[model samples]
Target: MRIIKAAVLVAAGAMLSWTPARADTVPEFRGNDTGGIIAYELAHRVDARQLAVDHCASYGKVAKFLAVDAQYGGYVSFACRWVPYGASNQPLRTLY
Candidate 1:
C-alpha cells in the first residue's frame, strides 16, 4: 500500500510538471472580476513580475467605471482604488 501511494504521488507530480505553459497569464488571472484581473496581471508578469503601479488599477485596463486595485503576492492595498481617469465615476468592475 505504501509503495502504491508513493508511485501515485510521483505520477501526480510528473503530470503537474508536464502541464504546458501558455503565452498568456497565470492561474490567478482570467475573464471576470477576480478571475480576469488575475489572468491579465499574470500575463503581464510572465515576462517580469514588476508592475508599473503600486497596486492594480480597478477593472484593470478594460473597465473605465470603477477604481483600480493592484495585487502584490496575496495581499491587496486600497490607496489607489479610485480611477485615475478622474471624476465621471460609475460602478466598479474588475476584469481584463
Candidate 2:
C-alpha cells in the first residue's frame, strides 16, 4: 500500500512538473521594403518600438515609420524604412 501511494505521488508530481511549451508573442521589428529585422523581448509596445528603432538606427541609417498595426498579445507591428545613401526622409511609397 505504501509503495502504491508513493508511486501515485511521484506520478502526480511528474505530471505537475511537466508543462507544455508555450508560444508567446514578443516584440519584433522589420523593414517594409529592405527586409531588415530587429527583435526584442520587451513588455511594452512603446519600449519595443524604441529598442527596434534604436537597433535599426545602429546600422548607420535613418529609420522611417511607414505604418504601425496591432500584433498578437498587445504587441505593435512597426513597418519602417531605412533611408539609403545618406538621403534622409525619402518616401518609400512612390506615386504614380
Best by lDDT: 2
Q: What lDDT is obtained when candidate 2 is compared to the true structure? A: 0.50
Clash pairs, candidate 2, are: none
Count of clashes, each model: 16, 0
Give the Cα lDDT of each candidate. 0.41, 0.50
Residue 61's lDDT within candidate 1 is: 33
Tens-digit per-residue lDDT, 1-96, candidate 2: 999999999999899779765657433545443434444333242455455466455554445444343443333344444466766554332222
63 Cα displacement, candidate 2 (Å): 0.8
lDDT digits (tens) for residues 1-96 of candidate 1? 999999999999999889977755435532333322333355355521222132234444323222334445431212223345765755444333
Best of the candidates, TM-score:
2
Candidate 1: where is the Cα deviation over 4 Å? 21-96
Model 1 error, position 45 (Å): 20
lDDT of 1 at 74: 39
Candidate 1, overall lDDT? 0.41
